[model samples]
Target chain A: MDDQQKWRLELQNSNVEIRATAAENLCLAGSDSVAAAVDLVVACGDVEDVQNWAAAALEDIGAPPVDSVDALESLVSSSDPLVSYWAVTLLGRLGVDASRSQVILGKAVSDSPHPSVQERAAWALGKIGATEASVVESLKKAAASDSPRLANLASRALA
Target chain B: MFWLIVALLTGGGVSGLLNPDWPIVGPLVTSVKTQAIEYKNQNPLGLVGGDAGHESANTAGAYAGPPVQSASALGPNDKILMATFNIQVFGESKLRKPEAMAVIVEVIRKFDVIAIQEVRAKADDILPRLIAELNADGSRYDFIIGPRLGRSVSKEQYAFVYDTNRIELDSASVGTIGDPADLLHRAPFIARFRPRTTDPDRAFTFWLVNTHTDPDDVPEEVNALAQVFQVMQTARPDEDDVILLGDLNANEQQLGDIRKIPGVQWVVGGGVMTNTRQNKAYDNIIFCAPATQEFTGKWNVLNFEQEFNLSREEALRVSDHFPVWAEFDVWESSGAVH
Candidate 1:
């Protein structure tokens, strides 16, 4: 495999530092890094260093491929806060293309224990701008939440 | 007209014109007030917040139905508004939105010097464009941006945008704090500033360490910041008014060891939330209460959503974090004047 492919595989390496270095390298590769976006997103659940680089790489790429949408949607419910956060972040970056993930994102907003995840999910819903009744209903309920950040974002989505 | 006054106050000669790259030091004092533009013509949609249609809106520009005050009219050299705002992902996308850009400009025009974080862009147009819009009202403003920093490829930069007519940036003092131990996600961007004053020695010269910590690594980053604050304390023998501010990602009680600094105080207390959601206080302006006695005991979190009467989504388009500000005296309280 080519060096870029090798680095993409390194994201699944056993050593956290090696994985982090790989992610950082791919991130610096610019648009050439888009091919590694999915691996980078998966690595976001790793150690803090690795997760940070992976998340940054993913964010720098702007959006992952549409084929990775299902994987990202499932990861949004990951128990780890960072995992769910990055998942929602990437899905949100997908904008309207990730419309299919709204139900999961809505569930994250309404039921996720992590406030950050909930906040991102709420923000994602607004970015998606899906008019589904369930999506609208979830945002409406969240608008009255005690958490001002969540309520603010949900209200913004409704608007 | 504002640039002329800026030339006098900052010693930045009028020959420098309005270039963002022009050095902002030197003195030329003129009382020419900025010519007021009729908002009715420029803001056709009335989204700029101060015309007849939005009279009741509580925006940063028109917080209480106040008239559209010229940037020169904020007061000469009596007091200055210092603020911190994390313009969420400020880059090309946000720049494309004129309405969002207008709100951003309005909020910034209200402060003398605003520390901006989350400037994520590969190109360098963000700050220059912002400066252009700010000066669109004939106000003289300039910006100093640090190198892009972070552990990942999507690095972010820290910037300080100041109204040259009211504040003077010590360009020589601008640099990022050294972090050999790698304690912060983004090393703080440090710079010094002084207000426009008749007595140069009495100007309240102080250092600002602008930072945005990693959300996932709060406790550790905050603890390191405490050290950074202490280092700043001894960095300069003459300056003790070090106001460290930005999107710290932690509230008052959660600031970890930074609280251990003797007499260190933050302007935005537990009662105020900095995030747009209004539920979390993720940003603040911190200082040594004893050293910076110039603080006027006034502070606020400018809620653009409520002030501009924008939907939460539109507000988020401007930023997820609201601008937090604290007022301070233009002249040094404990300096040569005393």
Candidate 2:
């Protein structure tokens, strides 16, 4: 119907390049295209390439959609580490403004199976600066993690 | 009245003013000394090894051992203690561990000035709580916390906390390095401090460039740190004493670009591991040996596990990294004792 709607359709297209191009175009649209990019990322499901591209587009957008925090939170809790990584990274970029996602990020710090996902989650929690007792406890556990990378990241967040 | 006049006439007035035992000055000096002694007694270093009123009663099993001296007690009178600690994310998580907090306080109390790294953005409550705990025993301390810094989405803050009675921060001299090339992930934070000693001749000042390099970008940031140190040294030609301290994330063998600087010395060398895990020498207290002539050659890692009698797991909970410290004389120039 409109240019943004046209790009959203391309995002659903079976073509990989088309989806990437659509994601890039949405990024170029900046803050105006946040809702569509968020929708693309959420609806794209387990499509790693499309989700990754859309996540990067959201990162480029630089601002979180006011209503998209729930979708991003759901994405962060994804069992897939890549999806969790990209989503948590995007939340980190959003900073304290994404306060609603702090608890899930804190949980992911200690619970996430992948080190990178756990690291990103710890980083996001630090960015959020959440003061909850549970959040602090989760980070403390992660700080003593056997994995040096995860421990270092958790330590940085605790520091 | 006659004695007072005679005392004033013979330049005794000046001597009397400086004398700690003089009737007018005696009470104030005694009061300060009393306070220091009281603080030391209340928060004894050996308290960590005992069943004190610590919050970690359940988790931290009782420590039974001889009272070991604190790192602060080992320094010579003429020298001030300076330390750099990578406090592992120093935020809400650390606050949640009260046993860890107690051990941290004991280690920190051993230094007059400490440069803290990895302060998370938005965790402003940690420092105030620490200061409150430190001052509960009557020790006065103040801090200079910098703005959020880093090259990533998750930024951090650098802070300098000093004993107000021993050191005075040069408020105007606090700033972070500006990296136009973006070589460093987090620009080093610089601050100047003067020893709060009455002997003007012995009162000296120095600059501290505090930093924590990205682990992945250690080699480049380490080299860039040398450049930053050089620039900071030249920026303040009047102040020859400059110390760079933090979690370099690289040992002496890996200090690629930093070792190239002339007169530079790594006080904490590769032989010493400054981490609680005993795996890495991530923290360091570095300075130009020739320029900082006041170095007393006294330094050590604050091993909480051994010193505080903490279990390996409990110790790691405090911080995977240990504090590394060095002692430096208060005098800027070599001179006969007054």
Candidate 3:
């Protein structure tokens, strides 16, 4: 594969230091390695100690293309809190098509079992500026609930 | 008669032009006052209690039993609000974010302490404007800014604001809990607050930690969580308590690799919450000292979607996430600080 792929593989490999190096490199590798980026995140969630590289990899991927929205969406629905949390946030950072995305984002925010995933989805909706009725009501309920993070996301989104 | 009338008009016009006060002044002052009132009504500082339309209907503020029975009362009764939020930095360029920040502050006012993440450096408009407005409004938020670990130009990335009236901050700093450059972990922002000003140590002292973990973020999050827990476990007095909060980005479903971290307890009855567009919860607050019955703190996800002027069609126009809040006993003790 390409240098980007090579580095992405390194991020998913067994070596922690290599993974860190891969994260730094992937950040510079740009969009081609977006899969590697997502993979790194999923993989990092499983690593113990301090795998700062995984976070770096995801942040490096930054906003991805629309093609990957489905994959990200699937992860967003993950029962695993780690995968779900990062997926929601990444989709939020990358997914901005409010018209097409409102439903996708709405579903993720409303369905995720983890409050953080839900919170990030709500935030992504706000970031995309999805003022749809369903999104609003979901956010309203989350905000009114006992979760401060949800409340913050809801109020800010509406604001 | 025409000349005479012209002369009369000229005299009146000349006299009005020469004088500072004119017929327009009366109406102008009235308009200014009206505008001021309108501004205040819509202002976040004034409307924090959710005076907005439909959204207000669902807001706790709508039926709140006076959050404060006694503004400065004792322990169990003297509850204060503490919160943390990420004010998504207002885009790239821009140096002013008064309105953008007002959204956050208006919601933030109900709380006594707030820890903010992603507060962009001085170049960004939101942070400075936020500080200015809060200060101008006589806000007593004593500040402690977090460091910018990354190379990006964004200034102090993390920050803390605590109401001076409720807490006395002894010292604050950005901790490098798991600072390995390869791991891209931004240091955690920490501040110690004394609930009772008189005796700093004996009073309700707790650590308020604010952090934004790296997206598919570092293993550091687990380490950071563990370290904070350790600090609280060892340092905290039996009488005092610990409050830890931020966007953890991790949850129970995480594999044992992540779950192996020590002392980080998943808050019971606290799980990935829904009720938003994409239902999930990433943000969290963990208290380890067995939250005193007096300090039954939980999340307050403000459901602003149900309370705004925006309609169903325009709903997506607002933000995607919700603001999480919680009420806590600032001072845990009974006889003394309560």
The CAPRI class of candidate 2 is incorrect
- Candidate 1 or 3, higher TM-score? 1
List model 3 lDDT by residue over A1-159, tens digit each: 788768766756687756655654554343445766467556545542213334434554667666666776667666666666666666677645434566667776677666666776777877676678887777777667666556766666777
Top of the candidates by lDDT? 1
What's the C-alpha lDDT at position A117 in model 1?
Answer: 84
Off by over 4 Å in 2: A1-159, B1-75, B335-338
Report the CA-based lDDT of candidate 3 relative to the real structure.
0.49
lDDT of 1 by residue, B1-338 (tens): 22223323433322111222222221211111111121112223322332352233222110112222333676555889999998876776567779989999999998999999988766666677777788788776767677778754456888888876667654335557666545576888877777755554566878898999976457868998998888877654567788999999889989998899999999888578897767789899999988899899999999999989999767866887899999999888864322
| DockQ of candidate 3 compared with the true complex | 0.03
DockQ, all models = 0.03, 0.03, 0.03
Candidate 3's C-alpha runs over 4 A off are: A1-159, B1-77, B90-98, B122-126, B151-156, B172-184, B196-202, B218-220, B235-240, B255-276, B289-294, B307-320, B334-338
Question: Chain A only: TM-score of every candidate?
Answer: 0.91, 0.79, 0.74
